[model samples]
Target: MTTAVPEDALVLAGGGHSHALVLRRWAMHPERRPRRPVILVNRHSTALYSGMVPGLIAGIYQRRDAAIDLRRLAARAGVALVIAEITGVDSTGKRLELSQRPPLRFGLLSLDVGAETRPSGGMPIKPLEPALAFLEAEDLEKPAGDAAPFCVVGSGLAAVEVVLALRHRWPERSLRLQAFPKRLEARVLQVLKRHRIELQPADAPLPGPSLHCTGSRAPSWLQATGLPLDQNGRLLTDHHLQVEGETLIFASGDCAVIRSDPRPASGVWAVRSARPLAANLEARCRGGSTRPWRPQRQALQLLGIPGSAPQALALKGHWRLGPFRWLWWWKQRIDRRFMAGFQQLQTMDSIDPDASMACRGCAAKLAASPLTAALAESGLRSAAQQPEDAAELLPAGTAGSSWLQSVDGFPALLSDPWRNARLTALHACSDLWASGAMVTSAQAVITVPALSSPLQSELLRQTLAGLQSALEPQGAALIGGHTLEARHPTPAPASLGMQVTLCVNGQVRRKHTGTGWSKRGLRHGDRLLLSRPLGTGVLFAAAMQGAADAEDLDRAERMMGSSQHPLLEELLREETEQEELHACTDITGFGLLGHLGEMLDDDCRLQLDAVKIPSLNGALELLEAGHCSSLAPANRSAWRWLDAPAGKAGPRIHLNLEGLPIGGSRHRALLELLVDPQTCGPLLIGCSETLAMRLESLHSWHRIGCVL
Candidate 1:
């Protein structure tokens, strides 16, 4: 359910350590949360723990170990998560300008977006995501035996760890550390020498690829906000962590410095400031006073040494500890314990006990049983009578042309408004495409969430833009549409409360005498081909429970957003004219079995190769773990219609599992996937073996079964 955004919503901009901890606190202690809606805006779905960066760089930890799933955290905390790059902040207007969507207005705002590193000649080590990507790409391109010296520039512990990490990642490559002699501690210098890393003057010219761990500075975009800044351009905040002279704005982490007790930019300070930041943000939201935060002057820093037998060094203002193996273990424990705070959150499920989590997208459609019953009672032709994807609109005396029309929609599936609308447009167009017609025009009926007039307008703008993007690419014009506000807003993230419905019109070219492709023309021995993989249903269901992997969700979103025009074009290519496609339909709210049931003939039964069914990555595992779309049970009813003899109903479809393992976890999972409703799912086409083979050779289409 989507939560309505009030006029006084609190926005936390950036998923830095401090903001992440604030969310954790709210998750663990919901009673102490702010009264108003809390939203977290970040550029990515995962936040990297800075404390674990060295270990991650040295290959001591997996990427998941160091990354926090912001989506899960926000869901657990009852906060909305918006994944988008923040381009600028408007202090006077109380708005945050985003790169892709419209500007977001906030009643109270907090900034924990860590500082940016601007290196003169090398990649900046801050903003670890892109930096890590660059490093990985460089490693892949450069041979292991390359003698080129990789350089790290800085005298800080971060630079030293990065240099050592390079040594660990590429053992044969020459590694160089550029730091001033006066800035380096004796023990640190000794560790560098022991690792065979050459130390050069800070000003030394780098001969190869280099990384800069130079200290933090405010992001250039923040400068446009006209906020108070310190010597290094970091935001200036009061003792209470509130932006100086601004009561409604707060700042923390490396991005801001408390003017009363300034400290060096470090992850330690970021962690230490979380508790106080959370308290102050909550206090400000409830119309209460905030307390001042006084941080300790010195923080203990632990630096890990990467080698066969790892050790760590601890440092304070003037005190230094030994590089012992115990220290390394201790550091690992701290990092793991910190990460466990997020990982362990999986135990705290947010799903309501009394109500099942109704899915979004196509899975959210009304069940067929009730819809068919209602249509019959109203004396209207049911879908069974008109088994085609789109309705044929023939003008009274027109003999040369006929129009195909279809309307489809659902509540927003993704938090991003643009993406959700774009996918909706694609899903709506699939009907015409399934009928072997190209969309020529479309009209939309969009319902924006209940918000201020300005916010509603901004959301509508994004939705329209997304819809237009999908239509314009197919040479389809968006003629006109209607807009309204939702009566009751459900509580979820981003623009989940918004809904979109599109009515598409297309022209069908006659093949000899037939009007267009239909779903009823299946013959014996006709093979079934699927254009894309399945499992969007189960995957999204798992996502609502915070159990889906970020990578899997990312891959699923890419597939769902991709246009199916290329596949449609390929199927209708001139070379394939000799072999006709018997039937076709886009698998949607009705799962594969449900949609396939509609294509069956009285005497024919489909023989499916269970193992040949394509599923998205991690989908089978999710299914095996008992995650399924809410509509699966209703969709499973379609099994009754499968393999039935003429004038008779059979129990289920016949599976051609000759020697494969039976009743195994994977087998059951695959069976369940058949009834798992898809959102913008694949196109299922029936054709002869000759055409099937040709389509399968194209790589996108997979022949999953055949009518027997």
Candidate 2:
């Protein structure tokens, strides 16, 4: 079935441990980076190292110490990262329907999405999403009226950690660990014993053939999707990890129904499959048969507790130590060393441009270096682009309002492939918000470097997904877009940046435009209402250096993912009451106040109530402590101070002040709101009292204001 057309090969789906490790091994032996790989992952990074999860939960380890950093992994491996969830697969079409993309072609496919979670009925706790649940129930909103009892069911590692974590995290809440067994363990027969944790062993199962998963097991989504499954709802797979009957499609991880032998649903077996799975996929890409993957009999284990002293467990035996301060210290060393691999350190590089280093896909992708070079080679002048349709504009006859329009796009500034698309699209849509116009449609220009057909296709799919998500809510539709392959990785569309005229059909458009506005005309005491938070420039630049935390990065990502264009429309409707005059610009590489300075009239005095402006978490602190973004130096050159007793401060201006410091820990609560950037962005509706009330009522975004 392999095609000579170079378009045929295996597509490993998901960043499950097995698949993730397989990618690592494949990269290490890149004579075998799977040629037609279309790695499908729901998350950008698949939080590897589940063993340390309990230690992480117990506050024993930070998220970075526990995560694998799949972004770095994929980059090193030179693989496509299609961040999407697969809902269904059509064998007849050889296509997979992602939650976000059109049907994608797959020659030979394998899934390692992992089994979903099942929760105890009526129980407020969820075992799989333990971290989030714990944060919600115990951390954010504690028991107000009654003590909520902690009840967990299961005996395995996932269960054991939850029990101990609950005890450690919430000592005030009632602790109730209950266990009921139909039959005793075969070894402990005829012996009555008391243990801290209740042991449940049954000779006869709980009225069913399958083990009722109260722990981390198959969620309803798996059953709803209805992939080939056994009676127990486990996806049936062959010895080769290929799904039964559909050998062209494979399954791995705990979700797969590998009935050839009974195996514990442990991450160990998954990790062990790395070598075999990668080899088989590589072999398949080379037009050969897939190799067999065999699970190992045993793996070493570690038990974590949130106590002063630590207890250890493994296949070797149980060993309790007096104090694990030393043990935790040792563990920390090991974890740090393990996490070092995730740094942006590439293992391989080809010297010559036309030199082929065993490419598997249909096209040769341009390395990031060449991509940047091509973007820099653009001959366009430093002028803003204008739309040139022959339609003559009639002045708004002094009676009606008007709408404005402009367009922009750029090469991705992020290293994470999946997030790059999302952020770029978000950056592009910012123009719509800044112009105060509803985005009706978008025309795109995609430039993918020479790469495999599969890689190119996946990139295009991901790009379109990001655009669709950012635009649709504002009634914006991406109806038309053009894609071309080039010598660069930039997705810079031709529709951006040029000597262009902006046309609009609004009263203000015929009246006032983004003209005659300089630092002199802006009056003193004019209030500044930044539409979005700052720190995007700083945080993302920090991420490139691998200094940002996972939670902070995740928060930034989740915030940017939502459509900001709609928030602008909401602000416009909310601003109908007052006319302080709308004067604003969306925050971009120029940073918050840098862009704000551009909209101000010449010789005008302005006041930045360092306290009133909202900021994002960890932004000012990062900024003040010599952690400015890469764009900071460029932004500094744009400033020309006329009159400010604040001494014309630099990027850390948020912290520089005579009265209350804008970047103090006390001010962090407020600054965390103001510094976070909004993609597509919010409207800084500078109306009278209506703006504040509307923002309060909508509650979609945090509001902060200051009068200069």
Candidate 3:
């Protein structure tokens, strides 16, 4: 069964190993997961596994091999993933100050952000991303004659592994380890000498591009939280992993210092603590007793050496093993096993499989024929023919020029309400922009699912905030609208998500002149250009089925988030002459081909190069797997027009599309892409070739075909 409006929020900060494990554990036991809404806030969508950092540096593994897609994991675990940086905490208010957004309120907070290394005034590799970039940019395989001397500062295991990886990449370089008077085991010292690495003094300057993997400290912001801290400035926690004095706060991994069982900062402890941390969080949320986490006193350490031959050393307590090939193999097995958990993720359907994924925005609209017939039957079309996206209602009045208005809305497609609001507002405003109207005002009509008063209020605030943010920048004020609670007498077996609509009003710049752009302005022999790619519907549908890649979903979200207002402005700036700009319309629920059919007049037939259309990154792959949008069939029904006889037609018009080069898998794939419904899709423009070139230099667009 689904949950009602949650009374509390459990916020997990950071995408460290411990938190990644916690999410994985919750995915395994969904029933045991907390009822409170879970939120995971992080700086990026993916987390780097520290165990594979050395492998990455040594060129043994690629970036993807060591990274986990936290966004996908959160979706699987039923958690909301917020990409933001946590700057500090408000202990009294139970809020977290974020870098890019408003402070987030939470009922319980957990920090597993890991630790930061002390700045050495040189290059530090504690955070991992910057260090990885540096390694990738450097020519590590250069000849010893062209290479400078290399040095590492610190006596920790990270420093040892990094230095060895560097040496393995360039054996001839003058490699050195700088340990500040700290003595190492005899075996480790011998191993360093065997690799011809010189030990340098701590006070000495770094020789070249150095990696400082020194001892780590807690984030400086933690000190300001007023929580008890260790001498090393880490948050102090009790046996139960709760902050010493703060009952609602929890900490783990390198950032937390267990007072009773003091342990060093290590990824091993973080991996081992995932279960207890997850269990304690579940128990705390349930108002039950929590168990204590007991860390191992001595953990096994493995170190890799440089060379074509696979060699590694294992150390535990005072015992040391030989630098054997089998040890390296064993470590590889462990690392791959850990990574496989993320790489081979399977999407388990919690919702009914038969329940179709809902299309949002224009795609959610009823099919054109049925809607048109209804309007015709009611004599609405006979009054003035079907109105365009925006209608010029008035001539020049004392107040302003011709007035244009259009209304658009659809059920929510995204879990993020703020983004949904923004997209919906943008979709509505596209009609005004197409008419070359200056946006004046906007009003919203929102329908929210049944929920508690406070939760419903929060949803409305978030939705309107996004709408206002998108509209105000275009100089349009949100006058106001209406809201309703959509509660059915008998609830459906499935969840009823929220929906929104925006009605926008605008004024044409010129008075009593037909200089504005519209769908009917197409000229024969003009080139067709698209402002964005297609295939969002297919990608989203694949995502609902757990078949889409995480990276693909991320790319789709970015494409949807982009506003077409800027593109509209750029096109207007380039088209000095009104004749140079032909027909223009935003691709909404209908696929590109479907929208293109609307722009065609009797004299013009579209001749498209199937290969020229652009699409989302992994769109075609999903299509090959038989993934398609819910509205695809309706859109593809346009094939009737394309197949119709040229001279025989009644009131219904035909969309003549011919000369498509479809000989291979790619051509067939593009055909399928042409009919995929788009949300905030693209602006299909028919313009002169000269204008297309000018717009091409300013934007990323495609010239798919032309009007014949």
Candidate 4:
């Protein structure tokens, strides 16, 4: 964690091969680290090693073997990893527009996004990400010839390699190559013929899975940036890889064209360019001169052929090596060597023997008992004494309605900053909603995790963008907030991640009377309505343990990040209905039971059905399997109201809804489930039974029990 804001930032636009190599070098040598924070923006959490892509398609390498985990890589480099798609660039403003978050400001920007192949019909494999997706969907065991015929388009090394791999994977399938250039070497043609692949005419129709290995083209978004470009639309750069006439902008990989030393857009040049790119970036950050990048005239290339005893075809300058078994051995060695660098970062101290995965959202909060006690000890009762969702405030102006104010913040729960920001905003605004207030304005307080200055800026930008997107729809204006680096004297656990807090101000629709729309107004016979499901705690805990299913996590995240403003707006729409809404609160860190306990009085209690309460998918299953969040024990402390131990056969509670002991131990499992903390949790509303009946018809509202 850093204590102060960074003055400068270096942003990498894409996770191409060159950028990956540059990150690897930076991770290895902290002494050469740039003063500006280094941030890598990629579409996914990992970058696939293009070198072993053919081997991956041939089933010779595992998917993990071809992937470089960008999250792990960024952590190793002490930088920030932002997973977002770059839509375009504002060259004049030095900002990169993302597909989902706010535009990111960059002091220095590098584009190594690689290139994409635009296909007339077939699927293009040049962009790598989409190509990897296509490869993953391949069904090689479809009874070979029973499947449709496969075809390859374009006459490049990538096309040949892909065709050979496809043929090897499904030998019975009829494979055809529509080589436009028709300039493959004799040895390459021999390898193709040996696989029984037919060379089709240029006009041949593409049948089944057609792999397009045509020439690479720069992304269309780059052309609109007004950057100097070659005829092919690639950003033109000088010998030092800096964009021509733009010292702050740099380009590499297939997306860049070198004016001083023109070369084909191939993985070889991208790999070789990493060294000088890293050096020049660091030099520029330090206000020093840069060394020019010199590319090799001819680089060695290894091509893989399909078969059990596959032979490698090596080519360079005017020389071509044989289809020999020894060549395959050498090719395997070289590919493995290339991949080894990414896999060799583990040090003994980096390994932890007793590290517990801390969960995000409400699970990251301190225990309520201790927090409450500390506040009481400090005599800070203003917030505690009037603990509704939002505090009543004087109207900002005479034209404004009564004002309500609240503040909320939490450590990051998701690796994606956008998701975290959106959730945080929703979580913060839920307080205002519970108080029957319409969000008017909000200010953000962000604490970025320890990363390079550039990466921190990117993280803050994405977080605020997400928050803005989530709030704007509710008619809330984001004014401004504070940004700070988390300052830790010693290294903290990875779970103590970035945090974001939003101080929200909203307008109360109803008059600011003490009797209505307060947390203490539960009626004698009101029904308690829950707006959403529970179980974020257990689900997230399972996620940390790698025990949660992807579908289950997705369901939990969607439920947790959903907003409840609309539902509250419906309940508090009319004046008569507003009075019927006796009390309201959003279940968050306190868990359902802990928060519900706060709403109880000496004269009334809540009667809940164990099965009536909604829970996130797979939450109960994980809880039954003994998975619990780090904060579970603290939340469970409130379960003592039941007067029974957790696992003792028939635990029962005598808590009365207007004086009556409900059923016994059948609710035991649900008792534990009730205390599971929530993130963007549902609203717990106390309303008339008539209104509850009306609300029960809606999917968003659940009538869990009655308040008496």
Candidate 5:
């Protein structure tokens, strides 16, 4: 979320080339950016650079070389990155309707969503992601000799590049191109013949897997917006890239056509329009006049040749050049230089030294000291006093059954609303799982961003769906809930402005013996087991700074979204009945050390093998680089409770770090991770050493320490 004062929100509806370049420009020149919340909505976290897509397909470039990391770009530009499919636009309402989330309201909007290619009988290649997936799948499913002939349909640069790429990928496979002879230049046809690709009429029947690059047309969803479109179904815009007769709306890239000075839909024009489009959008946001953008009538196009040696054809208007090796080298240089701008981000310094970037997720929670102080001041029972993950409901239910309830939530840690809600649900249910309770029912208090009526309804609908998805598997029902709007709304890619708190009810059965596990009984020599790795706090904190790797973030999210039910079931299996769980609690906002302190008895001490502690990938590296959750400092205060002097206010829970060299990088990282707050973190279980060994063999749990 942005700290900028509430103002008109500017929404860039797509991660097209123009928008990506615009974001890069804004990152470089912050002063030129409008002082408003800027949001970029797209279907994926990365955008394929169209210019290098041909190279990528031909194996001249890797996927990473051709794809732009929108997450990092948005972070650098201070823009909210929303990864969601856009369904339609409410032009009159100035809102973008999304597929799974609410409509995004905007004071100013820009459409660089690119164009679509309708395929008559083959795969459409307009949307690069799906096409790439298709190629990869085909390659895996069909071996070289068994594969059918490859075909490309179209009479444009995209089709030509694809056909050549196919030849490079499978040299022995027969390749065919279906294109109108009138649309192709004589020289181009000659090159196709030289490459041994059969050229047929545009209406020729396709064989095997056909790749359709049949030019560009506006996405069908745009027609529902009631925007003025040219004959080809592209949004008609004036010279300044603004929709005709609409001040707040703007359009560029293949999805739009300039009415007065029309240019063919191409990546060249998209790249060229970036500067003007960005300037115009900023001007509109500032309530200033927009400048007209006059693009060159002809653009230089470099066509790659599929061969052992690198070669390319340069075309501009009526002028053409040979498939020279120098041209390919030049093209590679240009593409790399263009991509480098995004790779090397400018270092950002805080404008206010007093303010620091606070970590999101559970790390955003109130510190332990103030929270305990407040609870004491309000005459409420603290976690230390209760020593249970959930509160027990009064009176027994049918038979000897009792009830347990817990509520847990936090600000959005992820940009995807559905996934965020899923993570939140799993976190809320963790309390019940810790107490060996089966979740029965839950009620949610959902606070969404202030938006139009339709948007609010949509947001709530998606949120509830996410909640139901998580609870359904556990035999839990969503009985009732309340909804409200945030007092101050900020632009999010999806539901960052939304916060969900679930009051979960669970049932715990007693077999006429005793209650379920609580955080009070830790026998001496009992082993401490951690269900999962630590460092979600540090990873997410690094993500906000664009310092986290994409793979690491994806892994972390997968871990967070995984339910703890399976682990709970394994622990409660009859085979493990001989070994009892003595104490249990889920590590949450408070770091592991902070939460573990509650489970300690006055005479108990913990001897931990620092080397045995598992950490999420890159978490330690990030911590070593001075990145840590904002709550780490406050959570460190828990150390004072450990080994406190005699007569001091102490539970006397001393912590001894084993196998750790003091003042070393690894040691420092481990210490910070111990205090790093976690959202949907692991469960700390106290059990016998034999039980820990048995469980570790059965699951991924690690034995971190032993009670003394």
Candidate 6:
């Protein structure tokens, strides 16, 4: 692992099992960090070993336990980890095409990205992909609203495991299954034959000049590169394990199919390949000749559960080992140890140079979808008539009394309290605006961590300034507010917030509490139009972690700032019109989708134009890339109505919206002209088409997504 850091590149494009050991060796040796060699791993994270696939699928092991943490691993190995996906290599030019980073120029390269199963879906199944089915399975936290069937087209151990995992994940469902050129393995065929399972006899189908999955053969591109591949998709290589035609390019493990020393696509080959692969890389770096890779005649191969316990059919020679619990235990221990390297990384205060972060979630924040969904669900509700019959008919109480109030909160994730106060203030007045009231006064509700009194006061001053600035537009004054010192609260402070929230209560000059003006009284079928776009929930979460670009952050800030006042004035005008525009009142906390479901009327259903709905600058990209606000889960949990079948509306956005939004272009753009709840938030603006258009036409309409 130690040597002069060589600028001459040796690009290792995977973090497969063998490469991991190589990386670990590098990590422990500091020479590897500087000039050792450049290791280009495509996956930013780690890939799990195949042995733990069954346990992971069976829910016995957490995903962290099954997968390796490549980043942490590479870091420990003192190697630069380039987070990218490799498309292909121009070996002739010695350049590699990657999804991220510039096409790398390398002096020597070894690709063990591993083979994928038969291709499926728009996402290409990697050559000999292990999780082809499980990864593609629609174990959609919720049913896909319909029984959306997915396919797996392989007849190998990997394929069987995937199918069983899928079956287990969706216990009560009618799912279709399809396998081409079915019967595989001598043992499997014998069992199926005994159990009356059908199969097309080998060569009974037909012979063809062309290549197909019907025969075990490598695809054209891989074969054309001139790496050894049997007629099957397996990589063809020599006893030395050098991929054919390319001397420097060593292909081993599941990717290879040895000609002279034929071996099944099993761990034995990869494990055997590791010794030489490591030696080869080391020798190449040390300016020495590569060693020959010898494949074992037979080694252990374990089958994952199709319908079994902690059991496996082990392969060694012609003799098969018992499906013993002990074997499973041994396999479990090895896999667990590997995975533990990842999962247990942070606990080791003193970092090992070679261990990569094991948990993707260790540094990850909560998703945002559910957060918006929750707020949106509660933002609007019908109210029942609380009779205006005066409890005090006499003028003893000096006319109707009003209690000016404000409740302001910001997504606490933003570390600065002063900044949070500003955002929180903007959010608080939203309730006053939506309710068609003018703010009379506001106050600070202070909470602080254990700190010096001066620090507390300074914090209080900054917060009040932000609050005052935020509330001024609503014509509210910060009269007074309360504060407390606590470690945490039920609704955490702005530091952890996805979106800022605050409330300012304005007095109704013409108090109408007697009227059933509250949201609980509203009917269903009211078309749900948004005053703001649907990405603040995501944007807030993204901003909290500072994951967003400067433009995105600016857009988010502007969106929150602009959303206030504009909607408030609009609501105030509608209130004066004496025509009750809103049958209910609710702020958008859950999301446009979640809140829309709350007020559904029998004949009135929500119809939306996908493109018509506004989005924050990076919102669309965030949702697509699977970033969501932390609050998303709660929203989804509270509004199970989204689970119902309502045609396309059933699954609002068909994208991976369940997670927190990590703002990208759309979310940033949406934030530029959004009525997101963070700042003043937008009034729900429940009105007729004419009023909706009028609201949409206003310059301020851009602050909130246009009502129309």
Ranking by TM-score: 1, 3, 5, 2, 4, 6
lDDT of 5 by residue, 278-316 (tens): 988777766677789899999998998868886889999
Greater TM-score among 2 and 6 belongs to 2
**lDDT tens digits by residue: candidate 1, 1-708:** 111233566889999999999999988888778765577899888999988988788777788889999888887887877778999998888898888567777888999888888656689997898889878877775676765688888888889988888788877788888888789989999999999999989887898888888877877788888999987888999889989888678899999999979998888899999999998877776666789889999999998887899899999999999899999899889999999989989623655743337888999988878877887788875664456689878763567656889999998887667778999999999999898888999999999877767557756877888898788889999999898888884554436788999999998754554466889898888888898899999998898877899878878988998999767777777224568888889999989988887776666678788888999999999999999998988887776653455765553368766676878888879878888999889999889988888777786688788887
Give the least accurate 10-residue stretch of model 2, judged by summed lDDT: 492-501
* Candidate 4, 523-617: lDDT as tens digits: 87888888888888888776555455545666776676667777767766543634467788889887998888777664556677666788888
Q: How many residue pairs clash in each candidate?
A: 7, 44, 2, 3, 1, 131
**Alpha-carbon lDDT, every model:** 0.83, 0.50, 0.76, 0.76, 0.80, 0.49
Instruction: Give the 10-residue window scoring lowest on summed lDDT in candidate 6.
Output: 382-391
Task: Tell me the lDDT of model 4 at 520.
Answer: 71
Which residue pairs show collisions in model 5? Answer: 82-493
Clash pairs (backbone) in predicted model 1: 1-491, 2-490, 2-491, 2-492, 3-490, 3-491, 3-492
lDDT tens digits, residues 122-241, model 2? 342333344444444554545622554445555444555556665556555544343344322332211112124334452323221111224455334557654677654567776677
Give the deviation of candidate 3 from the true structure as CA RMSD. Answer: 4.5
TM-score quality measure for candidate 6: 0.45
- lDDT score, candidate 5: 0.80
What would the TM-scores of all predictions be?
Answer: 0.88, 0.74, 0.87, 0.73, 0.76, 0.45
Point out the worst 10-residue segment of candidate 1 by lDDT.
1-10
